[model samples]
Target: MADRATMERIWEAHTAGEFVAQDVEATMDDDPIVVHVPTAMGGSGYDGVKDFYARWFIGRNPDDFTVRSISRTVGDDSLVDEMIVSFTHDIEVPWVLPGLAPTGQQVRIPVIAVVDFRGPRVRSERIYWDQTAVLARRRSC
Candidate 1:
């Protein structure tokens, strides 16, 4: 089972925008880790996962971005986190909306993440959100 402390640290790093390859390496198992995101924005394996973070997530800089936790459920080897993610769309984020330019709109969306762990390290993470809500907000902007 994964250690709650380690998982918390990983989540904290991600929210703080301080997550890096080293963090991934430290918190995740050496084996390939599966990552799933909305709209097929995900990858498997260590390198693939790293590339996804570099290109889609960590690379982009949003204005006033924040992720606040609403609730959490922990199990023997799994953890589920319900969160509110808010950010201003002042920069291009192709992963979230492909071929769409920045609309300079503020968005608040609920997100859920299911994390699976192997021992003290993470094995996989699946994240879900309402893409339609984000798109609608962008359209209105």
Candidate 2:
């Protein structure tokens, strides 16, 4: 089991845009699973699963981002959350979908993340969100 404080810190850090998430291991059958869904990035795992926010999502100063609200459901060693993510895309980067160029723009999308813990570290995780929503809002340079 993980301490509530530690879990809270992890959530806070994630919301704060400090993207050095340690041991954010994820799996298909994991408690906190980002069920297979098609988005701008395609399907599961880190690279193609959840869209990056810090330096990868927008490709600019990540400090401009914020996580509005986080609702958590705690378990023995697992935590699941629904997050409201808000951010401004101000740079150019690769798209999770193949062969798509960067479209610098600002976007906000709601997402859900499930995380399992091994002590104070995450053992596995899964995240779900809408990539189409993000892509639809992109602005051409």
Candidate 3:
């Protein structure tokens, strides 16, 4: 089971736009590692995860986003979290939808994540969220 402290740190770090490679690594398995993401933003693995951010956040100003609240359910080696993520698309980012111009919009979306941990690391994760809302907002701008 992942401790609350660790989870808190994860939330804080994510919100700070500081992508801790170790944190990402702690949430995956050894074989065919995968991170199942919600709609709008599909899933990926280790390098893929990093790549996703590179294309998504890194493409823009990392300061535009923040990760919050990582509520977790502990079950032996599994840790499930419903995290609250808040961000503003004030800067130009890569892969972001066109016409979905950045209105400097700030949004808070709840995402559910299920992760299997190997010791202090994560083995695999599946994240779910409301993609339509995200798209609607992006499009509205």
Q: Score candidate 2 by lDDT.
A: 0.51
Put down candidate 3 lDDT per residue, 12-111, tens digits, no spaces: 4433442434233333334323433543443355666666555564435436455565666766566577778677777654333324556677767787
lDDT of model 2 at residue 51?
40
Ranked by lDDT from best down, the candidates are: 1, 3, 2
Residue 89, model 1: lDDT of 81
**CA shift at 78, candidate 2, in angstroms?**
1.2
Cα lDDT of candidate 3 equals 0.55
Among these predictions, the greatest TM-score belongs to 1
User: In model 2, which runs have C-alpha deviations exceeding 4 angstroms?
Assistant: 14-17, 20-63, 93-104, 139-141
Tens digit of per-residue lDDT, candidate 1, span 1-141: 546776676555544542233245556556545454667876688888777767776756575877789999887777899998787888887667767887888878898988787777667778888888778878987
lDDT of 2 at 73: 85
* Residue 107, candidate 3: alpha-carbon lDDT: 65
Clashes, model 1: 0
Candidate 1 wrongly placed segments (more than 4 Å): 3-6, 13-23, 34-36
> Which residue window of length 10 is worst by lDDT in model 3?
18-27
In the range 14-51, model 2's lDDT, one tens digit per residue, is: 43433334223322222222332333332344543344
**What lDDT would each prediction earn against the true structure?**
0.71, 0.51, 0.55
Highest lDDT: give the candidate number.
1
Please identify model 3 stretches exceeding 4 Å from their true place.
1-32, 40-64, 92-99
